[model samples]
Target: MSSNSSIKCTVKKPVEVKISDTKSSLCSGLSIVDLSFPNNSEKGIQQIESISFKNAYTAFLTIKVKSEQNSSSTGGKWKMCLHRYQLMTSPHYESGSQDYFKIPSSQMLFVPQDVVSVRLILQQPSSAWNQFGIEQVSIETPTENTNEEEAISKWLQQHLNLNSTVKKKIENVEVDEVSGGLHRMWALTETVKAQQTSASLGRYEVDDSYEINLLSYT
Candidate 1:
């Protein structure tokens, strides 16, 4: 069986972001802003495609996920997916302030499955900025069409079950050498023709009147 087929599947829904009520500060001068997903279903999130958010004076960001091994289980442990990821080049400056950012799945340490909740820990080391937090936070996952296409492709591959002889025959198929040479020659001629630019009359005004409206600088 394929690796994808071996993994457990669940019903997926849109993820919602909610600000956690519990707020606290660390002794290391780090301002914490906690965010959670309130509308996650019992099955929880299956996959994460990307995460987008607007930074608000936040220099660094840390992400953690809470997931349950079994949906029936009431408890789950927290796992760190992103640790002390830089959000800005300079904390004191407004380089990345209020700027939108999208972190793709490739950057994540690991893609968590059956994610019950997500936590975002924002930090601003410098005291120069009094306020710091993330805005317009959103989590994106693979669409239903993507999953459907994958399933269809897998099913087709499995059902077809082509033999090595047939596969070798298909792979060994060759194109007509004459036709290939003609195509290459045609392509080269088209490229040469495209490089030769046509010259036009340098006339801008039509009958001593401008074609476009002239801007009046007051």
Candidate 2:
């Protein structure tokens, strides 16, 4: 008797979410117009859903950075973003879907400890992408006592100290960029306030997070 091999659907198929970059409220950054902001009382974290995007294919993600701006005239300054995320286990990185982001290394003293939040605007309009899945995102805590390497590191040390340089350079291992075949990136800007643009950032998970490899037939 002859036996035949069978195809397995249990190959851990990607958690398909059919993300329409244009239909969701994922334009340049945080706005008082759309996005259902989740309660951010858990320290400093928030999750929003039902964000619409006109740049469907170019539809990236964004993080609304709500800086504690005082007064109504100068209230919370909102900026959206994307961050370079590295899994504790995996070496691959998660980042913007554009070309290259002029992201400053974590070593800058002037940049706040919370400037990772950026607006995710796409160069194209109303597009769709195969977002595998995001597991968890949480607020980054400031750590203490990290050693320095380059001359700039010493400069930061002289100005602010070891922690300053440590905070700047997260890790320099060039991970797989998302802008080539299956990825892209956006232009880096510091508009502070603008009418149109987009960006992205990470959201901490309540529990565990995992990374998985994905392939798209579409």
Candidate 3:
């Protein structure tokens, strides 16, 4: 995962739209082409879906918002999306919401595509002049193969560092070979004593005795 880029933003008002990156609008707005305006009352009326690239395996965006103080509408939800599939939904905001939050590919079980594009959909948003700003959009490229097993193994190793720095003597004990469950078990050895004797009191009145021994096991 490498390569990152930010998408250009187009700001819109109730009347028209344009391909401009200047922060002329204070807070909120919708995405649209020039001369096209979306219904402000409608939820998610604007969608930025044209940030296309090659070999993008993961994508994320930065959002900036101005919290509502005494406004009629509370801050609304927005989506970090791939096509129409959303990878994340922003939490409701009442005050200013500005941060660089990451939207990873794993959220939507996203697989790398040769031609990949990400879209940000704003739903029930307040005016762009007052509410939110789309900051930075980025996508990551897959340099290596990715799989569920490999991802899970990597996550477990990162969080559970049982054998990270130092090697343990009792490791990878196959507790259940049939089920393929692994654990750590002690490698123990012990010794035991055993004796055997025999005596006869008949005939020649002779007695014989023998000693037996047992060895360590497991």
Give all candidates' CA lDDT scores.
0.68, 0.31, 0.33
TM-score for each candidate, following the candidate numbering? 0.53, 0.24, 0.27
List, residue by residue over 168-196, the lDDT tens digit for candidate 2.
56454345643452343233332334545
Task: Give candidate 1 misplaced runs (Cα > 4 Å).
Answer: 1-28, 70-75, 146-218
Deviation (Å) of 167 in candidate 2: 35
Over 146-174, each residue of candidate 3 has an lDDT whose tens digit, in order, gives: 66778998987765576654334335544
- Which candidate leads the pack in lDDT? 1
**Which of 2 and 3 is ahead in lDDT?**
3
Error of 2 at 152 (Å): 24
Please give the ranking of all candidate structures by lDDT, highest first, separated by commas. 1, 3, 2
- Scored by lDDT, model 2 comes in at 0.31
Better of 1 and 2 by lDDT: 1
List of clashing residue pairs for candidate 1:
none
Error of 2 at 78 (Å): 1.3
TM-score: model 3 vs. ground truth: 0.27
TM-score rank order: 1, 3, 2
